[model samples]
Target: MNSFDSSIETYLSNLHFGHLATRSIASIADLYTFKGLVLIPVLWWMWFQHDERREWRREMVFATLFSGLAALVVGRLLTHWLPFRVRPVYNAELHLQFAGSDLNDALLSNWSSFPSDHAMLWMAVATGIFLVSRRIGVLAILYTALFICLPRAYLGFHYPTDLLVGAAVGIVIAYVMTRDAIRVRYATPALRWIERHPAPSGMLAFVLCLELVTQFDELRTLASSVVRNL
Candidate 1:
């Protein structure tokens, strides 16, 4: 597995170019990896536009958001419990392909590189969305693959297997969350509460927006601090 990962990384690193076009692709790729930022607005629009299926849309939005949170939690747990894995660019021996000056070394160095949180979150949300609307779900899947997963791999942020396993975990969790029994037993009640209490829900959304802007680094730091203190 090490050899396979290294060989693929080598191939990709060799393909890196210093062209404006390549940098543009990498920039877009970085932008889309934050699934919450891009998808939340889309989900909001969908929730509002489909008046006929407003109830269903509400459920879908909640499911996707919940599943994404689950993915982040699970991914963080895996990173904590599992052996520390260095990212490709940080591996001193490996020659990683990166757009010069565009790569943020500090950001790349801070996190473990096992199961990709980005892949997991987006895949979970994509699968959850699919449960509600097939057409949009299909589009989400394509976007995840093309714009999200591939770019991460190409940019040496993750090994292909890291993405594969993260995506698989996300899909399974999302599928389970969207099950009829689960939805009836849990989601329905949660949605009812939110509907009854819009103010609190709005406040939560505002907090979430701030967290997204910071890329949840504060939350991660808080979690780490708690673990260390414990």
Candidate 2:
């Protein structure tokens, strides 16, 4: 396993190009990891505008949110329990090739790179969406592989195995969350509560959007601090 990881990282790190095109591709890929948030508004519109698909739309939204949240919780727990693993960029033994200034020294200071949180969340969302609509699910899975996971690996943020394990965990979480027993036991009650309380739900959604768009760095810093202090 170690040999396989090192070989792949070596091959990829050797292929780095210091060009504007490569930088652009890496930047676009970084953005697309968080692009699942874009579905919120689109699903919102579909829920109201397309009455016939309202049930499906609602399920889709619920699945996405639930899966993403579950992935984060599970991924973080695993990271905390597992031994620390340095990212390729920070590992002294590895040759890391970064294309642009987007990846800075401070970003590479952490040693929590065993399982990628980004891959876990995005893959979970993709799998959840797949359970809702096959076409969108297939697209989401492709996006996760091509745009989200590959770019991170290309940039030396994670080893390929980190993504594979994280993605597997995500898929499992999505499947568990979509189970009929789990849905009836948890999701139904939660959805009913949200439906009964619009103001709080809207406020929560606003806060989530704000955090995702503007305060993600701060949130990540806080989360890291909590994990370290634990």
Candidate achieving the largest TM-score: 1
Candidate 2 lDDT by residue in tens digits, 93-152: 665555533564575566488798777887887787777778877987897788778887
TM-score of each: 0.84, 0.83
Per-residue accuracy of model 1 over 70-165 as CA lDDT, tens digit each: 888899899888887887766766746554335655756777889988788788888877777799889888888788787777777788888989
Q: Cα lDDT of all candidates, in order?
A: 0.75, 0.72
* RMSD to native, candidate 1: 3.0
Off by over 4 Å in 2: 32-34, 38-53, 96-102, 209-216, 223-230
Q: Between which residue pairs do clashes occur in model 1?
A: none
Judging by lDDT against the true structure, name the best candidate.
Answer: 1
Report the error of model 1 at residue 112, Å.
1.4
Q: What TM-score would candidate 1 get against the native?
A: 0.84
